[model samples]
Target: MDQFILTFLKNASEKNFQQLTGRFLPHYFTLISKVGGMISPETLTSIQKALQEGRLADIVSKIQEVITAAENAVLEVAVIGESGTGKSSFINALRGLSHTAEEAADVGVVETTMHKTPYQHPKYPKVTFWDLPGTGTPNFLPDTYLDKVGFEYYDFFIIISSSRFTLNDARLAQKIKDSGKKFYFVRTKVDSDLYNEEKTKPTTFKEDRVLQQIRDYCLANLSDIGVSEPRIFLISNFDLDRFDFPKLEETLLKEVPCHKRHMFALLLPNISDASIEIKRSFLQEKIWLEALRSAALAFIPCMTFLMGFDLPQQEQCLKGYRSYFGLDDKSIEEIAEKLDTPVQDIKGHLKCLDFWSLVKDDSIVAKSINCVEAFCAVNGGPSSSVVQGFKAYILRSKFLNVVADDAKHLLREIETVNIA
Candidate 1:
C-alpha cells in the first residue's frame, strides 16, 4: 500500500487524482472530522489546489488546527443502573482496570452507588465514565431524576441491568431521549446466565438458544415501559469479547460525533479483533496528513520517530504503542490478573516480538522507499519535509499494524475456555 501510494503521488495524473478523490468522498451519515484529519473529496481538492497555488502555509495551518482539536476532544460517558447490577464492575472493565486496581470503581451490594461518581480511564483521562445513581433508588422522586443526576452533562448514557429492565430504567431512557440524548440498554452478568444454563441443562444447551432467550426477555421487559424496538446488549463485564459487547462498542463509535471519535477509538481497550481493527483503521486514516506534517516538521505524534530522529522521542513513541494496544507492562499485569492466567501465558502470545527485529529499527522500511525523496519533491531538490514525513509515516504505519496484531493475538490467547 505504501509503494502504491508513493507511486501514485510521484505521477499523480488527473485520472489518478480523480480515483483518489472518489475513494475519499465524504461520509455524511456517520462521523465528521477536521477537513484534513480524515480523507474526503474536499480534503483532496484542497490539498491539490494548495499545491497548485503554492500555498503550503495554508495547508500546514489547517493540519495543525485539526490535530490540535483532535487531541483536545473530550467524551463523557455515563453508566447508570441499580446497585449490584454490576455498574461499577462494568466501568472498571470498560476502563480496562482490574477490581484490585486503585483506580477501579468501587463494587457494591444491593444499593451502594449513592451519588454520581466519575471514573477515568487510566490511560485516557479525557474519556470519563460516571457511575450514576440508579433511577430506582428510593431517595429521589421519579420526576426529578434527570436534573438530580445532571443528565445534561453526559454525552451518552448506558443503562445496565443484571436481570431485566425495570420501570425506573425505562423512565430514565424516556427522559434522556426526550431531552435529546442517546442511551444504551446493557444486560450485564451474561456469563453467569450462560454458565447456569450450561450447568443445569448440559444435554439441551445451545449458546445461541440461551442468548436468544435472554434477549427476548430483555426486549419484553423494556417494551413494557414503551421502549420501541429496544436494543439490549447482553454482556459479562468480565468477558467483553463474548456476546454483544463488541456490538455495543461499535454502536457507540458510530454514534459519537466525528470530532470526538478519535480519542474514543484510541482509548478502547483491546477486547476483540474487531476492536483492534477499528483502532488500526482510525490510525491509518491520519497517516497521509501526519506524513505531510512530518515532512513539514524536519514537524509532528504518529508523525514522531525519524530514522535519525531523536532516540528518547522514539522510545516514548514505542511506549505509547505498547500502552495504547494494551501490551504495556502494567496493562499486561492487569490483564493477567483479570484472566487468572500466568503473566508468562500472556507474553507467550506475543511471539512476533522475538523474531521481528525490524520493528525495533526498521531500516528495511527506509530502504524499500528509495522513491520517497522523488515522490516528496518535484520543483528541484528533495524537500526535507517530504522526506521526513514519508519516513515518519511508513515507520509509524508499520508499528501501528504490529501493535494491533499483537493485541489481537494476546486477546485470543487469554480468552480460552479458562476465562469463564
Candidate 2:
C-alpha cells in the first residue's frame, strides 16, 4: 500500500493530486451511501444527525472536513537545555536551518534566558521549537522554569545536555515526569567528541560502536538518576545525522499522541529519506485544505494572487517543497559555514527549471533569506554579481526547480498509501 501511494505521488502533477484529495471525500460518501443501509445503526444515527444539523455535504465536502480537522490538529513542543549546550543550534538543525546568519543568537554558557524563543516551522507553523533556558542552576527550580516557559503549551519537553547528566538535568527531568509531561534526554556535542576521538585514535574502535557506548553510558546514568526506562538520544548539533536524530524522531512519534505526531515529524531536520517521508506525509495530510482552496482558486475567474507580507505566498508553498526535498536554505547555509564557503557559493547551483517559472524574482529578503545570504557572503561566495542582459527562453517556469519534483513525488506517495 505504501509503495502504491509513493508511486502515485511520483506520477501525479501537483494540480491533479490536490483535485484528487477534494474528490476523495465525495467519492467516499458515495460508496458509503451505496451501502448506507449496511452501516451499523449507530453510524446511521450519526449520518441522520449530520443531515438534520445541516452539516452533511456532498462526499467532497465531507472529505474536506476530515482533512481540515487533521490539518488543524497540530502539536506544540518545547526544547529546553543549558546554555552552551547548543540549544539554539540544535533548534536550527531540527528546523532544517538555512543560513548561519539567519540562525538565532546563541546565549552564553551561564546567562539566564528570561524569555521563551520560538522558532516556528516555516511550512508547518503549528509545530514550533521553543528554546527554554536551562534550569540547571544552583538556585533554579525545574517547576519554576516550566512555569516561566508556559509548560502547558508544549506537548512534550526535550532536555538537552552537552556533557554528563548533571543534578539540574535530573531535577528538570523529574519535574517534567511529575508534571505528567513526556521528556527526552538529548546529549549534544557528539560531533566534537567524534572529532576529538578521531584525532586521538585515527583508526580505533568502530564509530558506530563508540556512539552506542556513549548512548549506553548516558542511558545508564539517567537510569541511576531514577529516570527509569530513560531514553537517551545522542546528537551532534553540528552533524544532525551523525548521532541519534532519527532515533529521537521515531521515539517521539511513538510517544506523542497520534493526532499531533505528524506535525512534530514535519518540524524535524530533513536529514534522510525517512525524514523526508515523514515531512511529506504530514504536509500531505495538513495541506489538504489549502490544496483544495488552491484548486478552487485555480478555477476562479480572476487572477487571485496568493500574497503574504512575511513570506510571499508563492514562497510559502516553496517552503513546504524545500522541507520535503531537503532543500531548506538554512541547511545550505550551515553547510557553507562548515566548509568556510560563502553562502552564495553554496547557492550558486540554485537555478530555475527549464520551463517552470513560479518565482518572478529571486531576491531573498525575509529573515530566513537574509540570514542565509549573510552566512554565505561571510564564508566564501562572490562578493557581487554583474548585470547580465542575456535571458534564457523557457516554455513554462516553475516556482520550485527539480526540488519541487521530489516533494511532489513524496506527496503522491502519501496519497497512495493505505493508512486504513
Candidate 3:
C-alpha cells in the first residue's frame, strides 16, 4: 500500500511488465528505489554487484520493454445509432463525464456531431468511444452511414436509443450483422419513466412484475422488427443500478468476442466482482502473452543471467497481478452514478466473494484466495446455509461467457474476411 509500491505496480502494469523477481528483487528494488537518491556510493556499488551477480538486470530490462508496449496499445470502439438515441450521453457516461449539452452531444438531440466525435474515458484514453452521427437522417441512406463511419475501424458497435427503434437503427443493426460485427441494443433513460410509474403504482406487489413486463415489452417490440427472440437491455444513462444496466452489460459481454472482450472489460465502468474478474482476466491475458514472449526472447543458450532471473521472474510476476486489474475507484463511482445502484450494492456484490480477501493489498496475488475469511470479516458472510444458492444465482453464473463466445465467432469471420 506504500505510494512507491502503488506507483511501481501502476507503471509496471501499464507497461505490461510481467516478471516476478521473487523475495530478492521486489524487496531489493523497492528499497533501492526508496533510498536511491540518498544511498552512499559504496552501498550503491554493493547493490549493483548483487543485481549483476544475482542476474536481475535482464529481468528488469525485459519488464521495461513489455510495459512500454502495453502503454502504447490502443483499442477503439465505434458508437452507432440513428440520430438522437443518446449515443453521446452513453459515451459520456461510459467515460465518466457530466451530461451537459456541450459535453454529451448527439446528432438530432443536440447539435449534430459533424464527424466522428471521439470521447476518451478518464481512466484509459487509449480506449476510445467514437460517436458517429445517426445513420438515419431524413435523406441519409443506410449504406451512407457505414461509409461515413468507416465500419471496419471500430472493434464493435454500441447501438443506442432512448425510445423505439427506428428504420435507421434497424438498418445500421442489419448492416453490422451482415458485416459480421458485434452490436448491442442500449435502451437509455429508463430511470425517468420507471420512477414515474413507481410514483403512480397501483399496488406494491406489482413493482417487481413491472420490471419484467417492461423487458418483455422491449423484446416484443424488437421481435416486431424481425429481431427474433430479441434480447433488449433496459438501461438508464442516469441510474445504472435501477435499470437493467447490469443485464445490458451481461448481454454485451456475452456477445463480445474473447479477443476484443478482454479489452472491452478493461473499458467497462468497474462496479461488481464479476466485472473486476473479467477485467483482470483481460489484462492478465496480455501480460501472460508479454511475459511468455519475453522469456522466449531471452533464449540465448550461453546467457548465464537468464538462468538466475528469467525463470523466477516469470513464475512470480503474476503475483499481486489481480489487484492491478480490478475496476479502480473512479470507474466504480461512474458506474454507480449511472446505475443508481447504491455503490454499496456494487461493493456488496464484490464483497460477497471475499473479494477484498482474494485481492491482497492492491495486487492480484493468486488465482483464488480464501473468501471465507473475507466473509467472516464482514458479519459472518451470508450464512453458510445459503452459500451454494448464492454461487448458483450469482458468482458462478456462465451467462456472460456464453454471450461472449457467440459474439467472438461472429467477429472472427468479419476480421478474417474484408467485406466491401
Candidate with the greatest lDDT versus the true structure: 1
Q: Arrange candidates by TM-score, highest first: which order?
A: 1, 2, 3
TM-score of each model, in listed order: 0.83, 0.59, 0.53
How would you encode candidate 2's per-residue C-alpha lDDT over 160-214 as one tens digit per residue?
8887787677877888888899998889888878777788888784688778778
Winner on lDDT (2 vs 3): 2
Best by TM-score: 1
Candidate 3 lDDT tens digits, 318-339 = 2223223322344346556655
lDDT, each prediction: 0.71, 0.54, 0.50
Off by over 4 Å in 3: 1-74, 100-115, 202-205, 254-257, 283-300, 303-420
Residue-wise C-alpha lDDT for candidate 1, range 30-73, written one tens digit per residue: 22322222333455567556545545455566666666666787
Indicate the residue-level lDDT of 38 in model 1.
35
lDDT score, candidate 3, position 383 = 36
Clashing pairs in 1: 32-258, 295-385, 295-389
> Which has the better TM-score: candidate 1, or candidate 2?
1
